[model samples]
Target: MLSRMKGSKILITGASSGIGKAVAFELARRGVKLTLASRRLDSLRDVVEEIQSAFPEAPQPLIARCDVTRRKDVKRMVEECVRRFGGIDVLINNAGTGVYGNAEFTAIEDFRAVMEVNFFGAVRCMMEALPFLKQAEKGLVINITSVAAKHGVPYLGAYGASKAALAVFSQSFRSELKESGVSLMIVYPSYTQTDFFRNEKKVGGARRPRGPYASPQKVARAIVRAAESGKRNLVLSLEGKALTFSQGVFPRLVERAMDRIAYKLREKQEVFNE
Candidate 1:
C-alpha cells in the first residue's frame, strides 16, 4: 500500500543534523506535521527555522530533546509526538553513533554504546509508537541503517554490527507486523558526506576509505520517494547494490576482497598509530 505523506504526523530521531535533519525538511515540504528529536535542541531549532524559511506555508516542526539510548527519554519523546500531532503516522529511526577502529582494538564498550543508539534506540521508539502507528490509516516505520549493515567493512565492523543487528531485527519484527496496518522499511545508506567520521570515536589509526560519499540531501530525497512507493528495503548507491549481488553470487570472492581491504587498512593506518 502507498503511504501518504501530507497531513501525516511524523517523528524523526536525530533530526538535529545529518540524514535525520534532511528527512525532516523533506517531510515538512510535503506538508507533514513533524516532531524532530535529538540531543541537540539548539541545532534542531535551527533546522525548524530553515524548514519554515524554505516553506512558509508548510506545517511548522516541533523540536524535542531526546537521547534515544534512554528508555525514559524515548517514551517521553513519543508521548510528546502523540500529544502534539494526535497520532504518529510515520516513525523515522535515524539516530545513530559510530565507532571507527579495528575489531580487536575497539573497546567492547564502544560497540555497546553504538548498539544502544543504532539498534536498541530504534527498538525503544518502535515499541512505544507501535500502538499509535497501528491506529493510523497506514503507519510507516523507516529504519535508517547503513551499507555496513549489509557488508562488514574493516574499521566499520563495530558500527556495522550495530546497524546489522537493527536490520536483522527489523526483518523479524516486520513479519510480525503482518496483518497490522503498520509497515516497515529499512534504508541502507552508503558512505555519505557527513560529520559522522569526525564525530565518531577513533580507537586506532585506521585510514578511512576513500569514497564517493552521497549527500544527506540526496539520500533524504530517495527515502521520501521510497516511502511513497512503499519499497521494502532501500539500498542507495551502485556500489552497495553491486556488493549485495556479488556477495550472493560470489561469496568466496567477496570474502577475499574484504580480506584484502582489511590488510590494506591495517598497513595504511599503521603510520598514524597512537
Candidate 2:
C-alpha cells in the first residue's frame, strides 16, 4: 500500500543520534507522528528539540528510555508508543551496537552482548509491536541491517554475524506475516558518516573503514522512500551493492580481498601507534 507518510504513527529505536536521529528529522518533516526510543533520554530530548525547531508544524514526538536488550524496556516502549499515538503504523528497528577486533580476540561475553542488542533486540521489538502493526490499515516494519551482514568482515566479525542473523530472521518473518497486513523491509546501509565507530565496543584498536561513507541524512531519506514505495529491500550505496553481488558470485575471491583490506587497516593502526 504505497501511501503518503503525512499522518503515519512511527516508532524508531536508537533515535538519540546518528541514523535514528536523522530518520526522526526526515519523518518529522513529512508530518509523521513519532515516538523516539533509546537508552539516552537526554539525547532523545535534544533530538526532539531539534525536530520542533525544524518542523514546528509536525506533531511533537514522544520519547522514552529503552534498552532494546531488555524485554521489559522494549515492552514499555511499545506500550508508551501506542498510548501516546494510538497505534504504530511503522516500526523501525534501528537500535544496534558493534564490536570490533577479530573473533579470536573477542570475548564470548562481548560477542553475546552484540547479538543481544543487534539481533535479539530487534526480535523483541518486532514481537511486541506486531499486534499494533497488524491493527493498522497499512503497517510496515523496517529492519536496519548492515552490508556487513552479506559477508562477515574482519574486525567486525561479531557485528556481522549478529546482523546476518537479523537479516535471515527478517526474510522468514516477512513470509510468515505475508497474509497479515504488516509488510517487512530490510535496509542494507554500508559505512555511513556517524558516531557508530566512536561508540563501538572494541577488543583491540581497529581503524574504522575509510571513505565512501554515505551521509546519515541520505540514508534516512532512502528509508522514508522505501516505506512509501513498499520496497522489500534497499541497499543504499553502489559500493555496498557491488560487494554484496561479488560476495554471492565469487565468495572466496571477495573473502581474500576483504582479508587484504583488513590487513592494511591493522597495519595502519600499528604504524600510528609506533
Candidate 3:
C-alpha cells in the first residue's frame, strides 16, 4: 500500500500539527509528493525542516498558508498545488474547528463558525479540487471526521453537528464522483491526543472527558494506509466501532447513557471569551 502512494501528488490541509502533521510525516516517509497547508506559516516551516531532516530523499513538500474558512485561501492553495505538482491525485480535508458547550448557549454564530471550518471548509477544498481529482486515474478525497459525529455529546453538540454534516455530505458526494474515478473516504477517529481540546472554544458549563486518547501518529498511519488500500470508510478505535453498532442495535439505550453523562457533566460556569 505504501508503495502505491510513492510520488503521488497530495494536498493536506491543517498540516501544521496534530493528525495532519503526523500524516504529513508518514506520507513523506512513504515517498509521496505533498503540499502541506495551514493557517500558520511558521509551524508549517517547522514541519518542512523536520521532514527534510528526517527524510532527505523524500520529495520536498510545498507549504501553503491556508485558512480553510476563506474561499480565497482555499482556491489559491489548490491553484498553487496544481501549478507546483502538475495535478492533485489526493485531497486530504483535515482542517477543522470546534466549539465546546451546550447547543442552547453556544450561540448560533459559533455553530456557523464551526460549520465554516469543519463543514464548508472541506466542501470548499473538494469543490476546488474536484476537477483535478477527476482528471487523475484514481483520485481520492479523505475527509477527517469524528466518532462524535455518530452521537451528539452534551458539550460538543456544535462540533458533532459540523462533523455529521461533513459525513453526510461525503456519503452523498462519494456516489456522485464514483464514475469520475474520484473516490471519497470518510475517517471517523476517536478522541485523539492533540491540541484540539486546548484550542477549542470553551463555552463552559461542562468539562472535557479525560482519558484514553489515540496518538496523532497512530491515527495518521491508519489514514494513510486506508487511502492506499482504497478503503471507502475507516472508523478508528474500538469505541468508535462500538458506538456505531450500539446506535443501530440499541438506540434508546445509547441515548439514556448520553443523558446520564450530560447530567453528571452539567454545572454552572461562565463562557470563556476572547
Candidate 4:
C-alpha cells in the first residue's frame, strides 16, 4: 500500500503556476521532498523561495527546467530527481494546453500542438518515471485531466479530446500495472480558476469567460490526497461528478442538453459553435 502523508519524494510538472504551484505548497506542508519541473526556471525559483521560507527545516526543493513535450527533457528531469531525492515516490503529470475552435476552422497544427503537450507529454513523463517508480516500494502517478473528457464542451473539442485520450490511457495503464507497486491516478477537474484561458489560444470565436470554476488550491489538494491514498481516479467538484453521472445514465439526453445550453449561451456572443 502507498504510504500516507509525507517523507516521500514527489515530482510535479507544470509547477511554475496555478494547480502545480498550489500542490507544491500542499505537499510541503505534508513534509514531502519535492522536485518541481516546468519550462520557466524563474517561476520555479519563486515557488522554491516561498516554500523554503515556509518550511526552513525541510530539504530545499530541486528545480528543473523542462518542457514535458520533449521526451529527452522528461527523461533527464526524472533522472535528476532520482539522483537528488534517491527515487520518486510520486509523479504528477499536470502539464497541458487548451485549443478552442470548430473542427473545420481549427488549425491542424494547433490541435496537434494541444495533443503533443496534453497527451504525449504525459505519456513521455510517465514512461520516464516508470523505472524510478518501479524501484520504489510504493509509487503513484497522477495525470491532471478535465471534465471535458466526459462531456463535450463547445470550442474545446481539441482540448477535450486530448484529455479524453489521457483518461483512456490512464485506465489502461492502471490495469496493466495492477500487480506492480506503482499506482496510477487520473483526475478530471471541471472549470478551474487558473490562467488556463489566458494561456490558451482562442480561435473562431470570442472567448467566453466562465464562472463557478473550482479553485486551483482545491484541485491541488485533491491531487495530493489521491497521490497519498493511491486513488485510481478522481473527478474534482460536484459539478464534474454530476455531469459525468448524467453522461453515464442518459448519454444522448445529456449530450443534447449540453448542446442546447451551449447554443443558447453562445448564440448572441458568437463565442462558440458545436
| lDDT, candidate 1, 192-215, per-residue tens | 888787788877655577669899
What lDDT score belongs to each candidate, Candidate 1 first? 0.88, 0.90, 0.89, 0.85
lDDT of 2 by residue, 16-82 (tens): 9999999999899888899999999999999999999998999999999999999999999999999
Backbone atom clashes (below 3 Å) for every candidate: 0, 0, 0, 0
RMSD of each: 1.5, 2.0, 2.2, 1.8
Candidate 3's displacement at residue 109, Å, is 1.3
Q: Could you give me the TM-score of model 4 versus the true structure?
A: 0.95
lDDT of 4 by residue, 1-274 (tens): 2236358898999999988999998888878889999999999999999999998877789999999988789988998999998999888898877887666678889889999999999999999899888888777888899998988887778999999999999999989987887888889988888888888888876565567888998888887777666677789888789888988898988889878866765776656543
The residue pairs that clash in candidate 2, if any, are none
lDDT of 4 at 253: 88
TM-score of every model versus the real structure: 0.96, 0.95, 0.96, 0.95
**Candidate 3 residue pairs in backbone clash:** none
Worst 10 residues of 2 by lDDT: 265-274
Clashing pairs in 4: none
Question: What ranking of all candidate models by TM-score puts the best one first?
Answer: 1, 3, 2, 4
